[model samples]
Target: MIIKPRTRGFICTTAHPQGCAAQVRQQIDYVRKQPAIQGPRNALVIGASAGYGLAARIAAAFGASANTIGVYRPGERSGGRTASAGWYNSAAFETAAQEAGLKSFSLTGDAFTDETKARAVELIRKELGQVDLVIYSVATARRTNPRTGETSTSVLKPIGQSYTNKTVNFHDGEVSMVTLEPASEEEIQGTVDVMGGDDWQMWIDALREGGVLAPNATTISYSYIGPELTQAIYRQGSIGRAKDHLEATAKQLHEQLASGGGRAYVTVGKALVTQSSSAIPVVPLYISALYKVMKEKGIHEGCIEQMYRLFADRLYSPNANEVPVDEEGRIRIDDWEMREDVQREVAEIWGRIETSNIYELTDLEGYRREFFQLFGFETDDIDYEADVDPSVEVPNVSA
Candidate 1:
């Protein structure tokens, strides 16, 4: 099979195995060249297959020399259909980790279930004994409660009145107006249930109970608080409400583990092209404009760069005893993206952006390329026309 990107709206249905391997290698190479991190020796990364989660796993393994176990849900190739991009990504990552003599394992299933959690705990107890760092970066629209077996679905909508904003069709660079109606209370709660911190707390509690969480361990989860331009659709929206729950959970977890010198934090990250972000209304356009401004200023960063910085500069720096954080006790790695100068330029671009001048004013082309690249397409040196195998195995998958 010759795998190529097949898209329907924001979803990519096909992924190239070699291209995904190349993408993983690029991040690994970048991490290997940087100064080694004096961080965790054993780590567990939930949702460690794509986007920021994958980058965190790479940084922990290659940058800090940690043995890692990854939990993700990815479809494998079957019946002539290609595997999900995350599948290929995990396979590549585990292969590279083993080649480098670093212990790595992948467990594929619903991370929200008790069975999966129990299996992960068992793996940790048997293999690594104690994990010093836990990274929770799960992003999904739906979650099933392990306690109740009830499923909740998250929605991307504002909480109050309808929101009208300028958006772009990255497929064609067409800038237009999009109005998203407010979510109902039930819907907002549903979003919180799915995207909130309950599952993270459950994971931590299980790990601690299983005696696999190392003393003075640290746990981090990812979040986003974009500029005011995207407030209505993002920060002030239903997802924002979920983020509030997540941040609150961090505080609770921090207190729970405080007696042992353990810590929990919500790291607010920068905006970039992600499968989850692409689904939110008006964000793609904002990111396009943001990319243009940040690139011109030479401060643009993708997932790998941001994760590496989080580890090297903030988490494990020479002065890491006092990790830099904001008033709310959350790490603000999005500081550069939320810089005043960057926002000012993005605002100016927003005011004058139209379909006729979208390509001129924003980095829509770059956005499109990166968007495709998420599905293992648009990569450098890959012959998309060549025949390839769709069934690539994740060599270290367990349970």
Candidate 2:
């Protein structure tokens, strides 16, 4: 079936399989071309189908030469519809790994569930023996707590007081003020429950109990602390409360793993045109401006570049033990994004950006293209009008 891009606000409901495969190949090619990393020999990436999670897996496998197992819940093709972009991504990744003679496996299920944990443990024990690196990068709007049997849905709203900000409809470059009411206590807690580090902690505990975690393992999770421009809707919002919990969990996990020389870290990344970021108010506009500045300055780093740097430069350098971090003890890969020059220029753009000059002043076009690229659309390598199979199988899906 020939597939084209289909979209609702901030989401592409349809994905092109061949295009996804091409994008995966491009990432793998990029990693292979760069200097090899002295990182993990075996890795497990929870939420390993898209975004930073997928990029981390590629870097570990292609750059660090690690065997990797990925865990994700992606939609399957049904009723003549295409599978989720993540599904095709995993399929493409597994195929590339096989070609490269790297051991790669995909496990599809809810990463929050006990059953998925058990399955992962079983897979690790049987295939990789132990994983020295574990990356927690799950992004979801809702989560069902295995311990409590209750579901929590996350909301993107500020805390304490309402927030009003200039936001853009990236589709048409319409700039307008968006006012969001503050989240209630229940809503704030719910967001924390869904996006917090509880699931990450549980995964670590299960891995340790199952003896699939290497004694000297290093585990990292992704987070974002944008500049003051997006602080209210992001870092100081309901999601921010959850991230605070996540950072706290990193500390606890560090203590818990310190006995065996393991480490836990939160790597704060730069804002990009990810599916999740596109959903947040004011972020897309901010990212559009940031992208223009960074691209012009030649300091732009995408997920693949960021993940490779995290492994080579910070996590496993010659002085790996002395990883540089902020006062909060978290790695700041957002260094370039938060540079004084970048933020100053972005602030300048924010002050006067409106519908009329948004296109001229920002990289909204680039932002839109990347957003489509996330769903395997608008890619340069594949013909969208050509017929392709939507039922592509991930070569190494867990039995």
Q: Could you estimate the TM-score for every candidate?
A: 0.99, 0.99
Q: Where does candidate 1 clash, by residue pair?
A: none
lDDT (C-alpha) at residue 88 in model 2: 94
* Candidate 1 lDDT by residue in tens digits, 1-399: 877787888898899998889999999999999999998999999999999999999999999999999999957887879998999999999999999999999999999999989999999998999999999999999999988889899999997899999988889887789999999999999999999999999999999999999979999998899989899878899999999999999999999999999999999999989999999989999999999999999999999999999999998887766889899999989999999999999999999999999999999999999999888999999999999989989987974
196-297: candidate 2 lDDT, tens digit per residue: 999999999999999999998999998899999889999999999999999999999999999999999999998977888889999999999999999999
| Span of ten consecutive residues with least summed lDDT in model 1 | 314-323
Report lDDT (CA) for all predictions: 0.93, 0.93
After superposition, the stretches of candidate 2 with alpha carbons farther than 4 Å from their true spots are none
| Per-prediction backbone clash count | 0, 0
